[model samples]
Target chain A: MILEASDISFSYGSHQVLEDVNLQLKPGMTAIIGPNAAGKSTLLKCLSGMLRPKGKVRLEGITLTTLKQEQLTRQISFLPQEFNTTAVLTVYETVLLGRVHQLGWRVSDVDTRIVNQLMQEMKLTDIADRYLNELSGGQRQLVAIAQSLAREPSVLLLDEPTSNLDLRRQYEVCTLIRRLTDSRGISTALAVHDLNLASRYADWVYVIQNGKLRCGGEPQSVLTETLIAEVYGVEARVTIGQETRPVITVLGPVPVASSDFQSERDAGNDV
Target chain B: MQGTTANDLNQAYERLGRRRLAVVVTVVMLVLVSLFLDVITGPAALSLPEVLTALFQPGSVSEATQTIVCTFRLPTALMAVFVGASLGIAGAEMQTILNNPLASPYTLGVSAAASFGAALALVLGSGMLAWTTTVFVPVSAFVCAMFCSLSIFAIGRIRGASTETIIVGGVALHFIFSSGVAFLQYMASEDTLAAIVFWIFGTLQGANWQKLAIIAVVMAVTTGLLMSRVWQLTALRLGESHARSLGINTERLRLQTLILVSILTATAVCFTGAIGFIGLLAPHLARILVGEDQRYFIPLSALSGAFLVSVAALITKLLIPGTIFPIGIATAAIGAPCFAALALWKRRSYW
Candidate 1:
């Protein structure tokens, strides 16, 4: 399936967040790497049909807007930056919610099997009966990933899936994500802040700078030192490490350009 | 090691499942017992045989005893069950839609609007409806309360059905309608004020078979509709955006649940004034006992609510020797403390 977005624009009230954003993807891992407020999350929301944008999102050549909410969900599953549930449901019950679209009033055997398989695959078998409140941040995120995958989506969109995790958990989550996406042949889009992780896992990378798609392609080609410096306003070194992953080391914050800031402010008036 | 872990989990799940089932069944039994106790232990001195005879074989009992059981105890006892179950369902639905533990039909000004409607009818209703104030008051209360909630939900749609929006809208509507009732009280004649005050106190004193039948019909139809959407509702517990991502149209779900909640709450409160606490506490208590799965959670919530109101009525009867204290006040006294304890008690995430 081909997931494509074209000429998409979004604004929250008068503040325009994304403009004329375009992207295309096949079945592979894609990372939307950007600084804070660079419309990475907004673009994902647009593609997921959470927020309607100006143009069109085509999922496998069908206009996403034309599909009903139920029809669209079968093909696409989005995991937001933070999805919290304070209800006292067990981990098994929480993941079972992923099959909500399939279940009737009672939980079917097929549903139970799928939930059990996903929990086991995610290493959540031990905590299956534990309350969601009892889990740590990383564990909760794993549960949420299991939930998103429960629907068996062809396309998965995640917004900052590893932002809250420690170094090891981050690697583990990214590795799990890569393994799942690869095994399932699912096209996955992740909005990530960690550039090295993105370069490591994301087969394709889109570098967004200030709500615009600055550039995109292969990670090594797109995540250059100049692009990182310009987009994040940070001095950094980009190098190929032991493997093929682009390793980024930040030096210091770059001084702000008053002219650039003023011109951006003036551009905001056009919205 | 894996075998032991899986076995332990399976055992734990089974134990918890059995425990929840036991608690729910016990509560249902308690509600049934409370119904009988409520009928038999009234001010009228009816022994077990007399009360049973009045209940089963009216011809065997005296007319006065028959009248006492049929007219007073039966209707009031059943009203608690009907109203309790309805508000419990309403509270569970509201909490899911608003995503707030404290959310309920009463807390969201639904019952207050019903009271205001009843107050308006009492203060200003004329000859056209005077012959059947019973029907008129409830009909108008249902309409006005539905209108109030529909408007709240419409406003909520604009704001995305977040907790703050719903709660703030509820607080605003609550103040408006409650102040409306208070203002009507200030202007009402002695008879009118007394009637309105009595209605607002939320008693089962006025329950008749007819009112019970009407509430029962609405409760059955609405609850059936809600039961069909249990899976969707369970998904809603994961927050609105997540539910939406899972193919659940959260906005439509919120609107549907809100309207149903309004109807249930209005019908329940119109007959019995604005009874509080049951809607707020029942769902929380049910969640504490039986996790957040709506299939069991909703029914348990309904039963818990019925149990609370029925117990409240019995407490009201027992408080004094002869005169029956209003069940609504007794509920506040009884329920508020229980809610406080539940709130203060260190459980895993009350909200």
Candidate 2:
């Protein structure tokens, strides 16, 4: 199924967070790259039906607003940027809870099978009994992702999913999500801060700048030195190596910040 | 070597579920045992055989013994069970929605509102209603408790029903009602002051068949409603944002559960005159024994609460032999130290 958001605009009171943002997600890995508070998270929220934008979001040719919450949630799963819990819930139980809409007095066999299979596939079986609070940040992130997949959603959306991870864990998580997207034939979209990570893993890339879609295409075409310097307000060099993925090396922030760059910097600080 | 198989994983999870079930069953048995002890060990000092005969076969026992067992003690014993169960469920859901370990019916001013209502009745009698003092006190308390609860709900609704709004509103209401009670006490005559003090001390002495039935019916119906949303409640422990992303409609859930908890608490405390700490203590103990899977957590909370108050009732009878101690005072005197000890002893964090 294709997840489409068209001419979507959203604001927090009078301050607009997103304006005329249009995007589409097919069955592959799509990364939304932007600086802080650039409406990446807000747009993802709009597509997942967590927020009501002015324009319409449709999945498989049907409008999102027409569907009930339970049905909408069953098709699209969302993982927010910050989700940490100290409550004493175990890993297996947390994963099973991904099927919260379908859960009954007795857990069904199909739900059990899905959770068990996902745990094994994610290599989370060893720590299935460990409490969520006891796990490291990276492990918890992996468990959160596993829980999201347990919903069997056709579209999966994540916001800053690797914000707290180490370099190695970030690469591993991105790789796993990419593999799952291809294997399961589900459209996966991630809002990320790292340009190189998006270049390495994402099949399609969309750059959001100041609540609007700046540019989108294959990473090699969309991620350029001029584009990076313009959108991110930093001097950077982009090179396509033998691996065919663009690599970005940052120089520094723009020497003389423009008025627009300064305002975007201020908005980024609000987050 | 092969990694763990699906069969082994399933077995491990099922084993954990079984263990939690066992804990719940154990608490249920302890509650029943406490109920029996409460009935048998009152001031009348009947023998075990005599108490059993009076309870099951009243014809064989003497009329006085039967009256003592069935008429005088039975209602109070049963009241403790139902009231404790009601408070337990209320506290468990309150903690979940408020996202605070210390939250309870008392934290939301339900008990204090009830107290002020009782003080109004005891100090000034019923001015508007023609009912006797016997009916006036409880009715006034229930109305006042509901009033406090609804006002908090209204304030929360206006402010988007955030946790902070509800808690702040409840705290403000608590202080207002507490001062109202104090003012009433200051203006009362000696006899009325004594009556107010006695009611605040919270005795189960006023328990009757009608009050017991009302609490039982309300508790059963509310519990059934809560049980239907066990998955949603458990999802709440994951944090509000996550639950909302999963389409739980968290604001609506919080409001709906708050209403149910208010009704449960008002009914339970209005009859018993503000029984203390059972609502606050039971859910924490249940969380320690069983984690936040509401399937186990809710039932275990109710059972543990029923067990604690039932035991408190028994201690009230046995503490001074002939003199019945005020149940609220006994509950605090016993429960506080026990809860403290449990907190210190448990290596795992119960919160």
Candidate 3:
């Protein structure tokens, strides 16, 4: 199923966060990359139906607003940028809760099986009984990913999924997500900060700047030095690594007088 | 390759669940035993067999014995169970929905309102309805409690039912009612002042079959309603945004649960006066014993609350030979140290 968003606009009170943003998510990993407060999270929230934007967002030609919350959640599983819990839920229990919509007084065999299989696939079986609060940051991230997959959703939206992880854990988690997206034929869009990681793992990239979609295409065409200098206000060298993905190396910050920086700063003030 | 790991993980998870279930069952049994002790340990100090015989076979015992067991002990003991269970369930859900560990029935000022109503009847109902004071106090308390909670609900609805707004509204209500209660205390006469203080101290002396039945029905309804939504409530522990992403209407859930908590707290506090600590302490103990899985947390919270109050009732009997101490005093006296110990013992930061 393709998640198609057209003319989507969202605002927080008087401050506009997303303006007429249009995008499509097909089966495979798509990365929404941008600077801080660039409306990447807002766009994903709009696409996932977590936040109702102005225009129509359709999943397989059906308008998202027409579906009930339960139906929408079953189709699109979303993991926010900051997913932390104070509850002393174990790894298995946390994942099992992804099936909360279908659960009754007694947890069914199917729910348990899905949770168990997801934990195993995520290699989280070792910490199945560990409390979520007690786990390491990387381990907790894996558990969260496992939880998102436990829904078996066709479309997965993750905001800053690797923000809390170390460098190695980031690579491993992105690789696992890419593998899962391809193998399960799921449309996975993640809002990421690392441009090179997005270039490596994402089949498609959407760059958001100042509450608008700046560019969207294959990583090689989308992550050019000019696009980075325009959107990020930073000088970067984009080189094709041996793996045929654009590897961006940041050189220095652009001057404060740049037009993009002024617009980004103005947008920040409105928020 | 995944088969063995999945099976092993399944078994491990089940084992943990079974352990939690065992803890719940044990706490339940403890409540029953405490209830029995409370019933038998009154002024007469009847033997176990005597109490049991009087309870089961009324014809076999003397009329006075039957009256003591049936009229006095049974209703009082059962009322403690109902009140404790109601507060426990309400407190657990309150904490969950508000996402605050300190939230309880009293936090919303329902108990304070009830105390004010009881004080109003005690201080004002002197000559006009002297004979009706007995019924009037409880009725006034019930009405005030319901009014306070409904006011909070209405305010919460108007403000969009966000957690901060609801909590702030509750705090504002709490201050308003507490001030009313304080003013009532200031103007009360000497004899009526004692009565007002006693009512605020909280006693189960007014427990009877009628009040017990009403509380029992409310508890059953709220507990059943909360039980049906256990998974959704558990999902909330992951935080509001996460729960919403999982398709939960968190605002609606909070409002509905608030209404249910209001009814539960109002009914529990009206007849019994302002029993404290059990609401705050029971859920924390339940969380310690069994994590936040509402399947176990809700039932265990109720049982632990029942156990705490039942034990407090027994201590009230045992404290002095012939007279009963006010249960609220006994509960706070007993609950404070145990809560401190549990806080010290559990190293995990549940909040």
Interface RMSD of 3: 1.1
DockQ for the candidates, in order: 0.51, 0.62, 0.73
lDDT of 2: 0.87
Recovery fraction of native interface contacts for candidate 3: 0.88
Residues B246-307 of candidate 3: C-alpha lDDT, one tens digit per residue: 88998788778888888888888988998888988999999988999999999998998888
lDDT of 1 by residue, B1-351 (tens): 655655555566567777888988998999999988888888877799998998888898889999999998999999998899888989988888888887888888888999899888887774454543677788778887888888788778784446778788987898999999999999988888888888888889889999999899998998899889998998898987788778788878887888888888888988888898899989988888897888889899999899999999988888897878777798888889999998889455656
TM-score (C-alpha) between model 3 and the true structure: 0.95
lDDT of each: 0.85, 0.87, 0.87
TM-score of chain B of 2: 0.94
- Residue B329, candidate 2: Cα error in Å is 0.7
- Tell the DockQ for candidate 2: 0.62
Question: Which CAPRI category fits model 1?
Answer: medium
- lDDT per residue (tens digit) for residues A183-239 in model 2: 989899999999989999998999998999998988999999889888877978888
Interface C-alpha RMSD per candidate, 1 decimal: 2.4, 1.5, 1.1
